[model samples]
Target: MRRKLTLKDVSRESGLSTFTVSRALAGAEGVSKESREAVLRVAEEMGYVPNLAAQKLRGVASSTIAVITAGTSNAYYLDMMNGIQAVAQDMDQTVVLTDIAIGGVYDIGRERQTIQRLLEGRVGGVISTLTLLPESVKRLEDWEIPIVFVDSSPPEELPYVPSVTTDNYNASLLVGAHLQSHAFQDWLLLVYPPIWSSRKERERGLRDAAAKAGATIEVVEAGNNAASASKALRDCLGRRGGRLPDILIAGNNPILLGAFQVARERNTIIPDNMAMVCFDDFPFAPYLDPPVTVLNERSEEIGRLSAHMLTEIMSAQIEARKAGKPAAPIYTNEHQLQVPVDLVVRRSCGCPDPTRSRS
Candidate 1:
């Protein structure tokens, strides 16, 4: 029988100490980048497979589930994290939060590195809000680690992966119907770049609805931060000669806040002059001066479902291994789960709140 490749072999091939080889492959800190890369390359070339049994034995008392996300500053992500923690605490599983620098454009190199670091024997599974490259998805599949996506999904080119996301298209359709009820004609939609699937779907739904209603819709691609959103809104308003749209829709809470800043600075009136709606429902949304209308995406529910799905997949994989059977893929045609959204109406959308008496 062929001898199984070992760390000593990788150490010898990479001209590094055994300790260095082990630490590098395990993605430990303090190792030079050059040495880490060399050790990983040598191990791959020598077909050095990780000893899963030994790794489990070493840390049998503790196992972690990693949640990878971007833009921790957003309250949306924080809400989802809270839901995930609620479930994780009940199960007595440790959840580790990791952030990646994903944005409008996919960064394959950074994503791959992040996944490799998580795979170094500590994390038993992952729940990610960031969409990963196809290659990275395949790597996770080959390693037999379960991954459940929240709020985003892998590219269409890849096979179906277990994911939990909101029905954004339907949510936007509801927004469109609400706007139409007020006989609003011209519209302006401030959205993040089209790289995100959620953004694309929402835009599609709005465009389709607008086409049916004969209302003109103009889309502006604002960046994913408050500063960028403010700049984009200001520029769009300037180009229009200070004339606001009949109704303005902000893609998310951050974008809505930016628009609020600009509207206040320019002294724009609400509902009577221009109606406003936002896609996310945060705690402060109802407390705003006009109490902005918003789409409640049930972020906490998404997190709970995602964590539950990941745990189920991991449990199945464990059972399969114990029976000496190859683990089956978690995703199938039925794996796509969509949580519904609710529209909360307030003064911003020309709807009167009963709590506040009309003047």
Candidate 2:
């Protein structure tokens, strides 16, 4: 069997002292930049994997960061994961992916078990895309395990939990303004319940803009899945007595896809029948029959910032422990980061075709 590389091997290969190699690999400040670079390069080349278990047992921070998602199926979450993995790789930290049902049914037992397992595995920190319950947050606090939320805000009861999220309110406002400019008066917003902070903020913004534009906005509670969205849309259309709204706004990619399916089944042509817009610029948005207009939430940036914030918090805690000081939660009012979203105009919202030129 091939032998695993160790820190001693890296030290020998780089011709550096074992202490220097150790400190450099641990990202300690005492090591010179030149020495650290050389050590890291040699360690990479030699495939030197640190013994994270040993580190954890020694009461030092483990080199693993846990990234929690609602599920693994969505392309939106996949994009965010890509950004998170990139930052984790650059920092020489390992990432562990975990899932907990956040927007779905609230299973307190399952969530508690998941948290306990992560703690048992000695994960140094967490970046959660789901809004954990207040009890769950307290469990993590008890363990002193720092967590940074991505794509979702912490529950209102746990305001101290730091989060990286998009300005969904502003994004929705942009969409509302665009619709009003195009003279779309009647609006139908298909969205999940307000349990999700992003959806809540978006609904608020859209409602505000609708009021100002003298447009009537009707909101339907569609769950955050394709099947649920399709059912909700079909039910709404069936009960509307053949009166379709001027525009349809889907809250997310899955909801958009569901609505699209129902529209196709009912032979409802986009834009020509009812103009459409949605949040989340998924990869296939441009390839649809009438390419969809969307608000790009910059999900990748949210992931990157969340991971970076957790790393910073962990580093501070580590430094404090080393200095023989008590470690406290690092996230405060200043830690809440809101990334901006971009409006990607496309044909679905009555925009000009991208492939055509105007006279």
Q: Backbone clashes in each candidate structure, one number apiece?
A: 0, 0
Clashes of 2: 0
Model 1 CA lDDT for position 316:
77
Q: Candidate 2: how large is its RMSD?
A: 13.1
Instruction: Give the top-scoring candidate (TM-score).
Output: 1
- Any runs in candidate 2 off by more than 4 Å, and if so which? 1-61, 102-108
Model 1 RMSD vs true structure = 3.9
lDDT, residue 135, model 2: 68
**Candidate 1 lDDT tens digits, 1-359:** 14456788888899999999888977899899999999988887765656544665746412468888865656788889889999888878889887774433345576777877665553678888877777667666666677888888766777478889888888889999988888888999999876556888899999987877789999998877677788998999889998899999998887887788888888888877788999878888888889989999999989998888887777777777689887754666666799999998998988897578767
Worst 10 residues of 1 by lDDT: 101-110
